[model samples]
Structures are given as C-alpha cells and as structure tokens.
Target: MVSTRVDELNSERHRFALGIFMAVVVAHWAEHLAQAVQIYVLGIPRPAAGGVLGSVLPWLVHSEALHYGYALVMLIGLVALRPGFVGRARTWWTAALVIQVWHHFEHLLLLGQVVAGANLAGRPVPTSVLQLAVPRVELHLFYNAVVFAPMVVAMILHRKPSADERALTRCQCARPVLV
Candidate 1:
C-alpha cells in the first residue's frame, strides 16, 4: 500500500510537470500561428508585420528551417531543465507576463527605427541599429533584471539551508549529476 501511494504521488508530479511544459509549447505555437495569419492573410511586410501584429506573441519565429531548428533545440533544452514552472504559480505567471511585455517593448523600441543597413551571415540585412542608442540598451537590461527578480526571490525563499550551502560548495568544486 505504501509503495502504491508513492507511485501515485510520483505520477501526479510527472503529470503536473508535463502540463506546464505543454503550456509553454502551446503558447509558443499559438504565437507562430498568429504570425502566419498576419503575414499571409493580412498581407503585411515582414518587419512591420511581426512588430505590430505579432509583437505580443511568444514564439521565436525564424525565417528559415535552420533557424527554426536551432530555436526548437534551445527551447526544448530550457524547458527540460526546469521540467515545470514548479512552486508559486502566481509568481511564475506574473514573471512570464512581465517578460512578455518587456520583449514586445524591446521589439518596438529597438527594431522600430531603422536608419542604417545591417549585415547577417554574408547577407545585407536592413535594420535600425543606428537608431538604437546606449540608453535603450541600458533600459532593456534593467527591464530584464526586473523580470527575473521574481524567480530569484522564489529560489531564495524556497531553498533549504543545508541544500543551499551544499549547492554553494558544489559550485566551487565539481558538481554531480543525479542522472
């Protein structure tokens, strides 16, 4: 009976983790769908379209398959690292919203004003780098810090003293992988 109860608990944990992972995946794909509709159905230009129409969207869309592949790998890896956004649902969701808002503002502020031509992978890409200044970069960095503050707080709050001390020590030495 004890073994069965333990198994059931583990199953519940796994299901919760899977649900969180699925939410992230679904949000990203929904963003992609919005981008497609904006680009094709509305007949909007690439740069302008993404910023105005798809700016609030979450997916990291790439123009080519290679870009998409790389993004997918990174996304999966990041998702796997946490497995779930465990603990403090309100805090995590608030963090996510802040991050999303900051990201959209980044697009609008950075990419909106194009004054010079930029190059990418031997291709002459036109961008607004000249319009972006040091102040904008600083502001964006500050926004990023603020957005991540909740996660940091959560970790500090949830960490046990023994485990925390051990983690600190392990950082100075070689860390062990549970798997």
Candidate 2:
C-alpha cells in the first residue's frame, strides 16, 4: 500500500532529476558551441572582449572534448549511484552543485591569476595566498551569486516531494501484494 505510493514518488523524483541534469547539460553544451563559434570562427580575442558578459561566456565553454565529456559522464552517472535517494534529491543536488561551483571558482580564480594574459595584475602576484585581482574577484562573486545561487536556491525551495522526502514519509521495504 504505502510502498506503491513510494515507488510512484521515487519515479517522479527520478524524472525531475533527469530533467534538471538535461537542462544543465544542454545549457553547458550551448555555451560551448557559442564560444567555439565566437572565439574560433568569429576570431574574437578574449582580452578585447573583457567585461562581465565576456568572462561569463568562457566559463561555460570548453575547447577540450574531454572536459565537457567528463561533466556529462558525471551528471549521468549520479542517477544510479543511489536507488533510494530520490526524495531528498533537491537537497543533495543543491549541496552538490554548491560544492561544484565553489570548486569551479577556485579553478577560475587560479587560472585567471596564473594564466598568461588572464592576469589583471599587469603582472603575476607572487608568494601570495590572496592575489586579489579586483576584476576577477568581482566577476567570481557575481557569477556565483547570479548564476549558481539562484539555480540552487530555486531547486531547494521548490523541491517536489519524492518517496523519501522524509525518512518517515514511507517505509522502504517492498510493497504488500494487493488482493
């Protein structure tokens, strides 16, 4: 009785999870395609386009196939990692995405400072735990706030119920046979 309802809820969460993943994947891919066309085909220099919008676009674009491929694989693989995690899906996913964004920011900040031409210092900062590139720092904050935060918050706040929406929502054992 309860188990059947749970199964239905789990299925619903799975569908929602898949939808979220697909949306992100498509958006990422679209960004990449746009960048490839803009940078390679259109021949726009990264520096010449220096601005908020300019930097935002490149973060989504990856010239390397393996880079995008790894993200796609991870996104797909997360589905089967746990059979019963469907209910708290939004909570876990929101947390996971926050971690992902933080990791990404670390890399972005590092690359911006260390990579050639990315440095706003006009020269590299040496022996510095905090390089403090104002432009890059501002952009980083903006990106996290505008792009990552809203998405994560929306998912968390509007999470639809799933089988395990709560541990006590329904028991996890097999459903009893219907007469």
Candidate 3:
C-alpha cells in the first residue's frame, strides 16, 4: 500500500510536486544570496540585512522556527522524490540527500541550542559546529549551494537517462526505454 503511494509520488502526473519543491528551494536560495549581497556588497550588518521576504518580516531571518522548518522541508522533499531517480541520477540524488540530512542535523542542533538558551562553543546566539568557523549566513549559503547543485544534476540526468539508467528507473521520469 505504502509502496503504491510512493510510486504515485514519482509518477509523471505528480511532477508538479517536484516543481513545487524546486520552486521553494530556489526561492530560499535567492533569499540567502540576497542576504549575502546585503552583507558583503551593501555593507549592512547581519542583523539588519533582511532579504526580500525578510524586509517585510524582519524576524523571519532570525527565527529558529523558520530555519528549522525549511530544513525539515528540504529533507522531506529529497527523500520523497528520491525513488524517481535512477542509475547516475540516483547516485547524485543520494549524495544530495546525504548532504541535506547533515544540513537538517545542523539546523536541529541550532534549534536545540536556541531552546536551551546556550549557544554552541559559548557563542551568544545559537550556533552549529561549522558556524564556529563560518558565520551562520555564509555557512547556510554554502550548504544550500552544495545541496542544490547535486539535486539539479540529478534532475537533469533523470530526465534523459542512458540505457542502463532507463532500465533501472522505476518511475516514468525518463524517456521510455526501447527494446
């Protein structure tokens, strides 16, 4: 029963779901890029450097709830869409999934710190282990790029698979394999 439902999710009719997930991911990426520009190019302080949506809802950028929610969404999206890929694409997708899992863990760690009122490594605000080396804004940008890149590659490969890949694919994501 569950397998049937999962197969449905990976079907061509449900491509819209994948589209929506990618849209959300792209929007989040834009926000991070905008924030980076505000900081490095505009000389704005991190606290004041609200991105597009952040300008309207200034608290959004600093909200642990928002950060953690997005991380959770990304993780869920990756896992749910994974079965659609095959061969090389499946490998790339798995890579992205692994990275996203780590990214989710980092967010969870940060959320835990925020809840506990103690930052990692004695920082004033909640911080991830990597945040000790890179600022939160920058670290998140790096994470998003790494995760996004592989997912994009996977999507491209999924759409146009080789013979072996087409044979391996369970979903109709790629062109139909010829005899």
Candidate closest to the true structure, highest lDDT: 3
lDDT of 3 by residue, 8-70 (tens): 888764467778999999999999999999999999998999888997899898899789999
Better of 1 and 3 by lDDT: 3
Report the poorest 10 consecutive residues by lDDT, candidate 1.
168-177
Query: Clash pairs of candidate 2?
Result: none
Instruction: Show model 1 residue runs off by greater than 4 Å.
Output: 1-11, 51-53, 56-121, 125-179
Error of 3 at 45 (Å): 1.5
lDDT of each: 0.40, 0.43, 0.88
RMSD (Å) per prediction: 14.8, 13.2, 2.0
User: What's the lDDT for residue 145 in model 1?
Assistant: 50
Task: List, residue by residue over 11-89, the lDDT tens digit for candidate 1.
Answer: 3453444345446544544554555566668886655444332465423332333333433443442333232223453
lDDT for residue 93 in candidate 1, whole number 0-100: 38
Deviation from native of the Cα of residue 103 in model 3, angstroms: 0.7
lDDT of 3 at 145: 100
Cα miss at 124, model 3 (Å)? 0.6
